[model samples]
Target: MRSEAASPILAFHEELASDIRTGLAGPGQKMIPSRYLYDDLGSALFDAISFLPEYGLTRADERILRTHARDIVGRLPGPITVAELGSGSGRKTRWILEAIARRGSTTYYPIDISRAALTRCALELGQLPSVRVEPIERDYLRGLSEVAARRGKSDRLLLLFLGSTIGNFEPAQARDFIREVGERLKPGDGFLLGTDLLKPVPTLLAAYDDPLGVTAAFNLNLLMHLNRDLDADFDPGSFAHEARWSAAERRIEMHLVVRRAHTVTIRGLDMRIRFEERETIWTESSYKVEREDTARLAKHGGFDCLSQWVDREWPFAESLLLRR
Candidate 1:
């Protein structure tokens, strides 16, 4: 369910095909890669989702950054490099950058998969004095690897993976991913990780399956992306958005449930994907973390949890992990 090809668009198409072929045509009922939900329109829809009152993860993380900006920045060495993975729109990032810039001039690396988003962030950050922005247009790991490879041995780097993006990965994968990040770090470097905490199921359900339907638009937009790029016939209207909390997994799952049996044709892959009535395509998972588990994972990944700042009201946490 992957592709090694280099062309961005081709690789994207191939990956989409592989996932569909594996998920839909194979053992699984159906599933789509959540990452593919970031096409231009999808990105914009997410920006809208962030603004929704029900979707408080963004605001909660922003509050934590604003309240503890200095403390968060102070934990890091001064005149350091701030690297942010999946730097969307650069709104929440400005809080971190401003805090860092107040101490001294700092380099900002905003990494993202969208070239347009990267360009926007770079242009916006460039306007800020005392901050030099170099945006990396690639997925988080590859971009982080490039930044890690280019760093000097004596560099002080504080990597930021905010907005509970870590929640997207399952537990074991989350640990392994954090370990990969730790492997890239030298002692004295730090990682600022934002994680959503387990909360009432009602709150969780509202955030994903919003009353405003913006989240639904964000989820269904994935179909539009495929329809446009892969030449697939997906009547988005035929699917309903669903958000369910899996208590055992401590995650909220987003799915698109087919209302009727139909076949989706992808011209690029020369494949037709059939779906059964009521079949669901699992789209994304947002995993909430326990405070103790976050600390344990940091230690397991070769880092010490230096500090944690939480907005107890929303129950969001921003933990600072230092490489050891």
Candidate 2:
């Protein structure tokens, strides 16, 4: 029984180690999967980032949900099941759930790779009347698949991909991910997508690289996560957090720029990696989109844009799409 319980943890560590090895040893720019940046500490730091004055994405998302929660919920049929991808703490989700619960009982499946986030989500959302919170501690797509399987044949699902998290993917990858999601849903099901709009380069840079340094702390925490989880001797202080806006790519990139060359040993993986001065490990990329692009993305994902609400204050979009 103990072994059975420990298997998942063992598998997670193995997968993490494998990804780190592949990412660090790969040709061209070394990179780490952005998902790894959301362990407990990383998630908490990100929650702090959302509150930073310079970071307005989270606020923009909440604003849309708060303003149009009922309108968005009204668009969907009753007896609906709600599922959210990467639902950190599910604080913004209250608006939608409250709106839904006012009509009928709701079963919310909040999926995330971070257990800490899921725990908080379950606790925070479980208190709502007529709402049942079922937290899924898994990556987005797989968790959504499980939700689909558990759903009744005629059930209408409202799948939410909020916080502009889709921006983490490259354009093509984003399309592929949405298509995969569409494959798991039935016709008439709905999708609520949040996307950050193209703004001034300075604003974009400020959101990712805030002057308060919360964003930097969030970026640097990824190294600390690796050090603790992988038994690695990474000098977090040796690498500085840097954010760059790529005009051509229409994205903001975060990287850890190594200050000096050094070698680090990963005792867990039984491997040693050498770093060169000025070389960087690309950590994350956040893509910004135009309003029209939301419709295009929905169409490519086998969804039709039903409606879109834009937040004027921060220039963010919340698009509602229905499966074709």
Highest-lDDT candidate: 2
Top-TM-score candidate index:
2
- Badly placed stretches (over 4 Å) of model 2 are 2-11
TM-score of decoy 2: 0.97
- For candidate 1, the TM-score is 0.94
Q: Global lDDT for candidate 1?
A: 0.86
Q: Each model's TM-score, in the order given?
A: 0.94, 0.97
lDDT over C-alpha atoms for residue 110 of model 1 = 91
Tens digits of per-residue lDDT for model 1 on 1-324? 345435654655677778766766676657877888887777778889988888889899999998888888888875688889988778888888888888878888898877778788888888888999888767778789988976656669999998988999988998999999998888899999999999999989999988889999999989988888768889999999999899989999999999999888888678887888999999999999889989999998999999999886788999999999
How high is the lDDT of residue 318 in model 1? 94
